[model samples]
Target: MKRKKTLNMMSEEDFLFTFQHGDYKFVFEYDTPDEFREYLSELKDTVKELEAEKSYKRVQQIFKKEEQIEGEIKKGERPANKENFTFYDLETKFIVGKKKLEKVSASTYKAYEATFTKLKDFFKYERIENLNIEDFERFRDYLSTQVVNKTVNNHMAYVKMFVKWGNDRKLYPENNVQGVENLADSSPEIPHVNYTDKEIRNILEFEEFEQCYKDTFLIATRTGMRVNEICNIKNDDIKQDEETNIYYFDIKKSKTNAGVRQVPIHKDILERVLEIDFPLFPEKTDNASQKAILRQLYRVVKQGEGKFFHTFRGTFMNRCLKNYPRDLPIIQEIVGHEKEDKIKLSVDTYAKGYQLSLKKEILDSVSYY
Candidate 1:
C-alpha cells in the first residue's frame, strides 16, 4: 500500500509522500512543487532512459571492511591482535614449547611437567591466557602446603618461566605475577671448596675406585670439565699436535654450545687419555655420575661440603684469577661459560676462532704444578 498527501487547500506546502524502509517509515515532505517536480523528473529519467531503479530506499548496505583494510595497508597502518595462537595452556606449552625451544634441557622439561601437573590439579581454569596475578598467588599458597620450601620455590620458577614465555608472544598479557618470590633457603650451607693439591692426589690415588675413575677425575680437574661432559667424551674427541707433541681433547658437544671447546691435555694426564678407547662413562647417567663424584668428594674433601664435580671448575677459575686475573676470555673458553669472541666482531671473521697454539698457552698457564 502507498500513502500520498495532496495540498489542494493547504496554505503554502506542496504535496508529500511516504515510503516504508522495512519497519521504519520515512515521510519525505516537499518544500515546493518545483523541487518535487524536479526530483520526479530525475526519477522518471532513471526509470525510462537507464532502465534501472537506483533509488535511495532500494540501496543495499555494502560493508567496506575489506576496502578499509586495503586503505589501511596503503596508509601504512598495522593491525593489532593478529597472532594466530588462541592461547597455550600448561600441557600444550610443556609439550610444544619444550620440543621447539632448545634452551630448555630434559631435566628442566621434567620439572616443568611435574610443576604443571600439580598446578593443573590445583586450578580449574585451563588456559593460562585468562589467568591473572591472584590466580598464581593462590597456586603458590597451595604449593607451600604440598612440598618443601625449596620445591615450592622451584614450582614458582616454573610458573615464572611459563608466564614469561606467554608474555613474549602477547598470550598471557595480564599474568605478570611478579610477587611469586622464592622462599629463603633455610638449610645449612654446605662448604664447597677447591680441593688442596694433596687432597687431589689422595682422590687420584684412592684404592677403592678403579683406574677408569682416576683417569676421568684427573681429566676433569686439569681441564675444568663437568662430570657429565667427562662421561660423554669419546675416543674420537682426542686430537694430537704435529709440532709440540702435545695432545688435545676436543669437547665437540656439551651441555651448551658454549661448552664445545678444544682443551689441551696436561702432560701428567695425557698418558691416561691415550689408553681410553671407549666413552669415559659409557652407560652412566648424570645422576649416577653425580653420586659417584659426591661419594669421592666425601672421601677426599671430607663430609658436609657443597663441592661436587663442579668444584674443579671453580678451582680452575681461582687458579686463573690468581695468576692472570684479567684473562676472563681464556677461562670462559676453557669452561662452558660465555666467551668474548662470540659477541665481538673480528677484523678477520675467517680467523675468528681460537688457534690451537693460543689454546695450548692458556691451558699451560692454568696447569697444575
Candidate 2:
C-alpha cells in the first residue's frame, strides 16, 4: 500500500492564535510548528463556513417571520402565530386610533401615549392573548406606588381605553381588560365654585395676563372654550354673516360631535381678535395653554388646582344654564352639549350648520359682564 498522508492532526510546536469578536473570545493552539501552516489554513476555511451558515439561518428566520406577519394581517387576525406578540404593535394601534379620532386634544393624546408607554414597560411587551387582568393589576399596583391615586385613576382609565380599543378590533379577547378598576376620587378637596364675573375681570385686567394670554383666556371665560379648542383655531374658523354682520368661531374640534357647534364671539373678545390679525393664540402647544398660560393665570388669581381653564368653561355654562332660556336649547347648543331628542334636529343640520343668528343670540347671553 502507498504511504497514507492523513496524519492525526495534533502538532507539537504549540502555535497559539487568539480570535475575538464582540463578547466571544477563542484561542487555538498547534503543537507541531512544521505542520502549523497547513492546519491553520484548514481551520480558517472551516470557521468561514460555520459563520456563513449562521448568517444564512438568521436571514431565513427574518424572512419567515415577515411572511407570517403578512399572512396574519391578510387573514384579518392578530399575529398569534408569533411566540411573542409585541406591545410595539399595540402602540401602533393606539396611534392609528389617535389619527382616526376627530379633534382629540394634544394633551389627551399625550396622556394616551404616556399610559401606553407605562403599560409596555411594566408588562415588557406581552402578547395580546397572553395578557390577562392580573397583568393589569401588576401595572396598576406599580402605578399606585409611583403616582397619586387621582393621577393613577386618569392613567388607568386610558389603560382600559387601550385594552377596550384593542378588544373591539379582536386584538385582545373579551374580558381580558376588565379588572383594572379606577381608584376612588381623590380630586383636591376644594369646594367647586364657578369662575365669578368679578374674578374673570380681575384676571383679564391683572396686567401680567396682558403680556401673554389675555385674549385666549378671555375667550375661554366667555365662551367656555377648552384651551385645545382655542389654540387650534384658524383664521378661516372665524366667520361673519354678510346678512347679520355677526361674528363667531365655528368649533370644528372638540371632545364630542356636540362640540362641533359654533360660539358667537362677544364684543370684548372679538375686538381683541380683530387687533391680533390672525389665529388668536400664537402658542400652539398644549403646555403653552396649560402650564404656561393657565399656570400664570392660576398664580395671579391665587386659585388652587381646582380652578383651571376648564373651570372657566364651567362658569360660562353655569351662567348660561342658570340664566338663559332653557326651553330654547340655545345655551346647550352653544356650549356643545348633545340635544336629548330628535325634535331639534333641524338646528343641528340646517343651512351649512346651526343658524348663525340663533347661535349669536345664545352667545350674547354669555359674557364677562
Candidate 3:
C-alpha cells in the first residue's frame, strides 16, 4: 500500500519517506495530509524532469566534443601527427592567406596559389620541413623540361614568392630553403612595331567579333583609351559640351591618381555611342558585370573570322604616331597612360585632338595606304 499522510490529527508527527531506483534515491519529509500529497506529486515530477534534463545535457555534451578515434587498429594503430604530412597540405593554408601573408595583387596571389599545387605534386612524398634548395631546383628543372623561357620565368617567380613567404613565417625552420634561381637566360623575342595604315583598316573592318569589340575599339582608337581604362568605361562616364562640340569622359586613373585626365571624345565614337540602344554589355548590363565581351565576340560578328579586338589599340597608337603632335601632353590624356615616353610622343603627334577627323583620317589612310 502506498504511504499517505495521517488519517487523523492525533497522529501529527512528521514521517520521513525514502524511495530508491537504479543509481538514484529520493528522500522527503511531510507532516500534514495536504503537505504530504503535494510533496509526493512534486517529487515525482521533479525526478522525471531531472532525468530528462540529464539525458538532454549528455546529448549536447557529446556534440560539443571533438571526435577522437578510439578503436584499436590491427596493424596501423598509431596517433596521427604532422610527421607524415605532405608539403602541399600546409601550402594550401598559406595560399588562401597568401595576400595577407604578403601584400600582393589578387592575380599575383592566384598565380602564386597555383604553384603550390604543382609543387605539391612535384614533391609528393616530401614533408615541408624536409624541402631544401635541391628539391625546389629539381622541381624547377622539371618545369623547364616542357615550358618556354617566359613561361618558366613566370612559374619561377611565383615559387620564389612562396618560398619568401614560408621563410618569413618560419614555416620550415629545420630546412633553410633558398629557392632555385632562374636558369633560362634567353630573352623573349620583341616583335617589330608594325602599326601600318592598312592594319588599322583590318582591325576596324574585322566584324567577325562582338559589339563589345566594335564599341571598345571605337573608344580606344578614336579616344585613345587604354585596354583596362576602356574596359572600365560606364554609360554615366560620358560628359558632353554641345556648344563647344567637345565631349568629356569622367575617368579614374587606373595607374595613379595623377594619371587621371579628361578625355575629349571623337565625333565618330560619339555617334557610335549614340547608336547603341542599351547597355554595352547586354547580358549583365550592371557596372559590376564580370563577363569579358571579347571572348563571346566571335559568335556575334558574322563577317570576319580570326581577329582580336586589342589590335585596334595598336592601330590607334600607330595612327596617333603618324598624325598627332608626337610630343604633345594631349597624347597622355588620350591614351590614359601614366608614363610619357617616345611611343606616347609619337602617338600624340599623330593623334592630336583625335576626334571624328582623326578617325576618318585613319580610315582613309588605311584605305589608301
**Per-residue C-alpha lDDT of model 1 across residues 156-226, encoded as one tens digit per residue:** 88778777766775554565566666777666777778877776777777887776677777887788888
Top-down TM-score ranking: 2, 1, 3
| Higher-ranked by lDDT: 1 or 3 | 1
In the range 25-137, model 2's lDDT, one tens digit per residue, is 65677545656676668667877877888899999997896676555454434354334545666666556556665556667778778887888788776676787878777
What's the lDDT of the predicted structure labeled candidate 3? Answer: 0.56
Local distance difference test scores for all models: 0.66, 0.70, 0.56
The collision pairs in model 2 are 11-31, 11-32, 12-31, 12-32, 13-31, 13-32, 14-31
**What is the TM-score of each predicted model, taking all chains together?**
0.66, 0.71, 0.52
Candidate that beats the other on lDDT, 1 or 2, i.e. the better one: 2
Candidate 3 local lDDT, 26-57, one digit each (tens): 88777657887998898889888888989999
- Judging by TM-score, tell me the better candidate of 1 and 3: 1
Better of 2 and 3 by lDDT: 2
Q: Among these predicted structures, which one has the highest lDDT?
A: 2
What is the Cα-based TM-score of model 1?
A: 0.66
